[model samples]
Target: MSTRSEALLARPAAQLEVRQRITVLLTPPGLWLLLFFVIPLGVMALFSFRAASFGAQRQVFTLEHYQRFLADTSAQRLLWRSLLIALETSLICVVLAFPLAYFLSFRAGPSRLMLLTILVIPSWTSFLLRILAWKVLLGSSGIFNSLLLSLGWIEEAAPILLFSRGAVIITLVYIWVPFVALPIFAGLERINRHLLEAAEDLGSRPWQIFLEVILPLSLPGVLAGFLSVFIPTVGEYVTPLLVGGVDGIMYGNLVQDQFARALNWPLGSVMSLVMMLVVLVLTFGLGRGVKVTDLAGV
Candidate 1:
């Protein structure tokens, strides 16, 4: 009957209510994930193990798909090439995005919003359209070739501009640069102006300040941007299909061929799973070394 005893007794009830509320709130999203993501992934995994047979009365599971993939040197090479391309694209995006982000964060002043809008406007258009636009620009008689011809850089149109690995990387970089910049811009915006002023007061040169302070603090955003671009680029098939020739074909194109052209769902599933695993491993491996606080210079 004491007040302390009563309060202790009520605590369990209060905890129960909180738990119930949390469960209720989480139920919908949990179910949604199970229904959509988990189920689909499970189905895909199942398909990867299933024997490659059409309209068979009995279903047989085997490891042959994985065995075949492992034995295929060309597939392995293509996978590595895709990873290399993705890394290249991500690095290029970061290099090109940083300066634009820095300017928007520090120098755009009253025009920051307008410039940012301009950066994002291109993204509002269809993704396919953007790629097609680049296709046109890189074509033999496209604007770039014409401009070069007029400038006497080349006597004839450069046929090598389009339908190459370089073209795929170029188009991907252009598509991703604005997106990458936004994250860097956000990170830069979070930086306290006082830090910059203090560095200046200590007589640090612009380059020194950037190297020691700005770069350190902006690393999280840079990593974010890099990963964002890298992950997608690794699985990119459409860009390579449209612009990249045989020499430019990536692992994604191989996977696409399995499902679309070859009608081999099991093999395609195995490839897709392998690509996903590789991406996940790389992402975690990269992220494991750097913490957000470390990147923020906190």
Candidate 2:
């Protein structure tokens, strides 16, 4: 036993050396996140418990902010609305992105890079500009109304499209389309053609192939895209402010107002924490629900 133990102990130190090297490499990013992400979150959490006076000053630590949200029915309703909108946006993006991604991966062939260039080109312009452009295209006196009027299809301009819930969805969809497409496209592109071909050779119909192969493989990308859109959209403030009105304003706008205008940082910080926790729970739950790893590359 001793001889065997010594033999094992006497093995090359290459594994330990490699591990040490890896540790050295990972330390920088670890420290960077510890300083930036963890530290800032800690600070925000500390502030979240503090009491806000009538004039924006925070006093000693208190549970007022946290309790206030729990007790406020309107705030709870607004939170639900924010979550629903985010989910809606994510669902829409995922539904639209899947086919486009499949096309880019399977049909576009070597031209994908070029297609991707055009697809993502809309991002070069400012997001606000994009929303404004949608306003011009959809508003009462916008181009669509003008076109319909020119054709004598309408007696008057369409209802003012600005400052509506639909408009907000349209603008946000435009802003985030690229985000959904890129990940799904990359996922589909990583699929092995042979697997698909083999499935087809076995007399699987197109729909069957897609159901049994393509979709199952693309689950990871779908989840990733969902996360990308849903998380941010849950906290969406700008789209609601620019394109939506009182009815369209989300929980994020309220949170922003709490901090910026109302000068209620304690509530804002608490709200932010609650929103983050909600997002984390939903992300993990969705990942588990979808079995995200199998389609990780897809």
Candidate 3:
């Protein structure tokens, strides 16, 4: 072959090699998504349209589940409550997490890693166990009540603490705060310190610097934390089951009951699909408001 012909052949071969390498890199995740996420979601979507159990004599394709969810006042209330709690949890997490994230990112100069480790260590523990521990702590004779009693803060052990809506919110906050804080801390870390210095040099107060420079810069992290906490907390079943009592029951509990106790697979699938749709809508809506260019300054 001529030199030019040889070069042309080599170029094609290199391109082909690159294509094959890219394919190899993508294959595992692609297969994983197809098998675990896409396929399962598709199956659930199919199930949502059917009115049937796992094994039944007769089956019918219907919108009964969706209709029931829409028409039923109880279901509506449950869903509303779930969303309200999730929103509350996300907001509270943001408020609580911002201070911690700020400290971890800027103030925890030497022991930052240690503090972060302490924050993360609890997440490694069994989720159920954490909820249960909270249950114990808020119980009548639990450490919290004991301390209060010793301090002469209350006349009797507070029965209202253990199995109340407040307890549910508290536990949800406790569980989700770390998730929210970590993202905010990451956002704070990515912030250019020079910006804050410039603000200070320009005679900006501490709060002013934070409001203008820090808060704006760290918004991406706050959004991430909000999404992380809000999405899962909406369908939270376990925590409410453990500590929420009757008043804390959420849509997730109904979904769980439908699947596990009632054996109403179709109904459960509908609930799951509805929750998924809400999550997708909210995510897209929130994401649309955030400009990618805004983070470029970081």
lDDT digits (tens) for residues 1-298 of candidate 3: 5776556557878668767878999999999999999999998888887878755522578888889877778876888899999999999999999999899989999898799989989999999999999999999999999999999999999988988888999999999898888878888888889999999999999999999999988888888888888988999999999998987788899999998999888888988988888888987888665444332312
Runs in model 1 lying further than 4 Å from the true structure: 1-29, 289-298
Best by lDDT: 1
lDDT computed for candidate 3:
0.86
Ranking by TM-score: 3, 1, 2
The candidate 2 region of ten consecutive residues with least summed lDDT is 289-298
User: Model 1, residue 138: what's the lDDT?
Assistant: 99
For candidate 1, lDDT tens digit of each residue in 172-233? Answer: 99999998898888888888999998998999998988998999999888887788789889
TM-score of candidate 3 against the unseen true structure: 0.89
lDDT-wise, the better of 2 and 3 is: 3
Each candidate structure's TM-score, on Cα atoms with residue i matched to residue i, is 0.88, 0.85, 0.89
Residue pairs with backbone atoms closer than 3 Å in model 2 (clashes): 187-298
Go through the candidates in order and give the clash count of each. 0, 1, 0
lDDT of 1 at 117: 89
- Candidate 2: where are CA atoms >4 Å away? 1-28, 53-59, 148-160, 289-298
In candidate 3, stretches whose alpha carbon ends up further than 4 angstroms from where it belongs are 1-12, 54-59, 289-298
